[model samples]
Target: MALTTEASRYRPSAIWQLRLSLFMATYVLGASALYPEVFYTSALIYSHKFLVGIPVLFIGGVCCAALIHGRRQPVRYALDLAQGRWRGCLLVLLFFFASLTAFSTYKIAIPSVVPYYADNWLADVDEWLHGMPPWEIVHKLDSNNWSSVVFNSYEVIWFYQWFGTILFVSLWSDEIARIRYLCAAALTLSVLGTVLALALASVGPVYYHHFVGVDRFHGLNAALDRLDHSYMVREPAAYLLKAYQSGRPSLGGGISAMPSMHVAFAVLNAYLLSSINRWLGVLGWTFAALILYGSVFTGWHYAVDGYASIVVVSVIWWTTGRLVRE
Candidate 1:
């Protein structure tokens, strides 16, 4: 389906714009007071990553839009960003920045606030759900190809799909649709997800095993160690282990893992894509399932974390959907 010609003219809702601006302003003030290093570091890091990725994103968007709609569609989008409708571009950038800030706040503040780990209770919940820890089952799988697939899907593919969706919708979809996704995502990742994560903070199986001498997850540890030796590229788990070993309070170095943002974002993406088409929605959901499985397989989260994330994001998406309709 094509974006409506009238809708193509971007005009953001004043209320949402003001709300977002206020949110960012408040965050900046609070972060500067409580965590000055995180405040500046997060701003620099997120801005650098966004700016570096924009050129490739823009070129890809232009090419894809040209093939789908026509050259004029891409040209209109470029002009809107540059001069024609700069507010539209500003709105997207603000939403993105706020999203990253939300993540930064969670990563920095949670560890500083809640130093206790909840892996014991969280692991019990996981056992209640799956008769055993999900990681135990996942670690049993052969590590030759599945390991690479799941690890890469969790690490690399997720980033591409997540940012790709944001870039595509911001440039190609009408303003209403784009705003709905942003609002839904903001609530899901920034507000609801972050709150839940902070409230029930725990490092996860790998850290639990490493720090606490809990042998419940030795299977996952062995599998990850094997992958580290086997894979050509450094595995995500190895990198995370290294970070934890370093013991330095780097930006986004906090370890709170009760509710998985990976699963929350995956579910949110699935729902958003469903609005575009059922098949795409199914694909999104499937990818989300893989991410959930990967989270367990890689020992980054308990199954309960992913389960809680699904429920949380579903509620946020439904609530935001109703608000948007109103």
Candidate 2:
């Protein structure tokens, strides 16, 4: 057989393919299991999106491919990558997809298989979140917007997951499965934390479980759902809806409380920001603030969960920093 090229020689194509294969392999295997570990976990409630997500994903794959035709020049770069030239870029994408999927799968795989806490917190939270009351103008600040500037926060905080694998790849391109493992680990924790918060904790702020007449301000909750509608049967860039639309706040609701991953990812971004850019560190703080605000303001998470999530993400960041050796 003729050699593809030296680039292909060092290229971790095999690992890439393996990562991609194993990524879905484990997910599908677990998803297809008669009864996944999650089923017996007694955490999630009703789960239905799994089957719905497949065909939507297939169509999305076709869409993304079609979209890529416009950016085909990058194909040469990818070819060079196949030859192992731009492993960082390749790994970047792999990390993003793998981590996102793994984390998502881990959190809800159990619920879909055999929703456990469907009646406990999942239903309660859903009933509570049925409709957000009009924003209260307690203080006449910014027209009682109750929202703040949050400069740079939105970008810095979100950048973590969006670009986490990319940065990891840039540093650990030489390390096989480094990004993959990191992604897996992050995802595992994400799912774990999300599940615990939603199902195990089964107790959010004073509202979800019981109405205290206190506005939760979970606007993001609804916004998230709106965006999810676009992807529910499409590409689902981040699989944002996996947890939502699952019936009763969907699968996402099943694991929506304590140790909020929103806070967790923000913490991760802040940690990474400190290393990549100092100004970004400042933004990381801003991002954390936004997340904290969103949690309480939106009533999606408890203040305690925000604190716990911070701790979790901090540890994950510290540990991952070492793992990637960056």
Candidate 3:
């Protein structure tokens, strides 16, 4: 169970040091290109560093060492973890798998649009505050094409899922056995959220399409389905769509969309990050707010859908955290 202990004691071998350096290099280069203003024409030569050069180089280093050293490295590490282990790894993994499997196995025979009562309440509250003309004007000003505003919020979701999950869970978790639970929590709930998306389908209203005047991307469910089918996209978001395709068109696979899994996964990451670092928890809240906004703004979900997702994520955070503790 001494996972963190091992990492702290780890004086990285030359190969591991190289791998670590490359990983950091790739992250910096890739993230720097996110802002258009920072994109320098003079640095165009190094711009390509993110696309292939840095990431590929980093990936190559890790793969080479892990593959070449293989079992020679992780044995002492594994033996350390095996000590005082409670065998909770399998149970946690199975719990996660079973939750997903059961959800996938039996499709709920209800819902295409479970609108957010909470969002409705928020709108009302905001309006009430707006009775003061100046404040109302400000609220209105802040409420521009929120769909597009939220649409761009996808970056935070990915950051929490991939980066936070990897860094916090992988680093802070001292118990090798517990790592399995983290994985199970991450992979299973994430997959289950997607499965639930098919069953509930809370895409807000088609008025969204008419408002945006884009007839092509229709229903929230339809858009998700299309993305699922085209999982070959190089973009990481495409992989999420693919995860939704895991369960078939059975009772388990109703193609509805009540609670958004995108929200659920973000919630999971938030919990994990909070457990690892308080600062991360605060960042997660900001991230969650944007994700909630993104759903409705992008027309990918209704306000109700976004609200429902928030509720579901809250539930998921509580349930899974308990699983880890117990």
- Give the number of the best model, judged by lDDT: 1
Q: lDDT by residue for model 2 over 1-326, one digit each (tens)?
A: 24678656546645454554565556434533633453332223222332453334333433443456527565454344345524444444444444444444445544454343332344344435534331121111222122333212332435444344334444334454454345434443545454454355433442343333334434434433333232221232224334344432223323435566667766665665666578978977776777666555444454556666676666665654454433
TM-score to native of every candidate shown:
0.84, 0.49, 0.42
Better of 1 and 2 by lDDT: 1
- Candidate 3, residues 1-326, lDDT tens digits: the string is 69987665543332333443354344334323432222232134333433453334333433443455546775454444334222433233233333433343222212223322232333344346545212223223233344234434664445435433433333233553234335434433433454445444332332323323445334343433333222221233334334334422222233233455555566666665576679988887677666655544333344445466667666655654454333
Report the Cα lDDT for residue 30, model 2: 52
Task: Give candidate 2 regions above 4 Å deviation.
Answer: 1-95, 105-195, 206-255, 322-326
lDDT tens digits by residue: candidate 1, 47-140: 7766776666666755666566655576665554445334455456556765576566556677668764687888898898889767778777
Model 1 TM-score on a 0 to 1 scale: 0.84
What lDDT does model 1 reach?
0.71
Q: Report the backbone clash tally of model 3.
A: 22
The true-versus-predicted C-alpha distance at residue 115 of model 1, in Å, is: 1.3
Q: Which scores greater on TM-score, model 1 or model 3?
A: 1
| Cα error, candidate 1, residue 281 (Å) | 0.8
